[model samples]
Target: MIQKSIFYTSILLIVVFISSGFKPYDNQIDKWFDLDNTDEALYIFPSQKNTDYTYLNAPFKGKFFVGYKEAIGFKESQNKYRKVNTLGYMGKYQFGAETLKSIGISDSLHFLNNPRLQEKAFVTLLSRNKFILQDYINKYEGKVISNIKITESGILAAAHLGGAGSVIKFFKSNGERRVKDEYGTSVRSYLKEFAGYETKNIPAIKNAKI
Candidate 1:
């Protein structure tokens, strides 16, 4: 009887191992894995589907208390503090070297490695944009451009994506002139996506820098 029980247990273990090695093809299994409810007994393989809930749900669907700057950081680099894009944009906010220098961050390596500095740089750049685009914000806020409502935070976010100059052209053209980065992400897209955030704490300082 003992020998028979051992033989059965070994066979069951082998079966489980073989089953776990095979990839799951069923869509329901894929969905179960996608939801992240891991079950060892289910033997479901991991799915490569994107897990970013933001994409799965409505735009700007997240915690109400999430700061706009942090949200932009998430969008820019998925909030990876040490991330560097192919074009050499660095840090959580994806600051170009020139922009980093403008904000008093001269060391790209140090800036990329330092999360706090990157956050400060974002605030500084936003402050600078807010100062530079104050008149535009006052004039354009609450105005509709291409069916999207304009807001101060939106303008600042667009300025962060392209530049204050590009944002100005965008506004001056009444949404007729669209500006996109090398990746083809448009300034209007940033404005529209990042709108409706409370950024009043970022005080506008003339020529703001870290």
Candidate 2:
């Protein structure tokens, strides 16, 4: 009788536990990989799409290999080049030759100035994209950028250029190597005023116009 009672109690507890949908470990870790990477998350040009279409636009050079599993699971980057896995993975996100071929070089650039290159890239993107400004802002407001240049030091950003009635803010790094504001103020302060957020790293270069 005692054994039967214990067995029934155990069964009842198990049923209750199952029915409760109780996860002993909160799935906080699952969110480490932001599965839904929006267009904003995409800062690298000559991306997979560009590479895939390289046949039409030959001489492409920006081919990033993005598998469904890895892309969905990317967490944070280590220093700059490597997107360190919060779960399990290693190595920098590799770009392919075809991808590189799709991106046309900036003939107008003479040097690789980060801010200047960033401005150029953003301007080009804005001019070519079919989406509205508001939609672009909403999607890309806080996303980081990466891999548009030849090296790990190639990160760039498109910050809000402040104007009348615009509450937008930008942020600059608060260190000795920080940039300057349009008004000659520290870039850190200027960006903060405009609520500018961080984006991925890209190489800043200046090329002469072709």
For each candidate, the alpha-carbon lDDT, in order, equals 0.83, 0.30
- lDDT score, residue 23, model 2? 53
Clash count, one per candidate: 0, 46
lDDT of 1 at 52: 25
RMSD of each: 8.0, 21.9
- The residue-by-residue lDDT of candidate 2 on 1-210, one tens digit each, is 999999999999999999899655432222333446642332322333444453631222232312211221221122123332343222222212221122343322221223343334333332322122333344444454221111111111122222201212221221234444344434334223223222222222232111
Q: Per-residue alpha-carbon lDDT of model 1 for 1-210, expressed as tens digits?
A: 999999999999999999998975653432323435554334445455666223622235353325676688778887789998999898888989998888787888888878788878888999999999999999999999998899888999999999999999998899999799989999999989888888777799998888
TM-scores, one per candidate: 0.72, 0.16
| Residue 10, model 1: Cα distance from true site in angstroms | 18
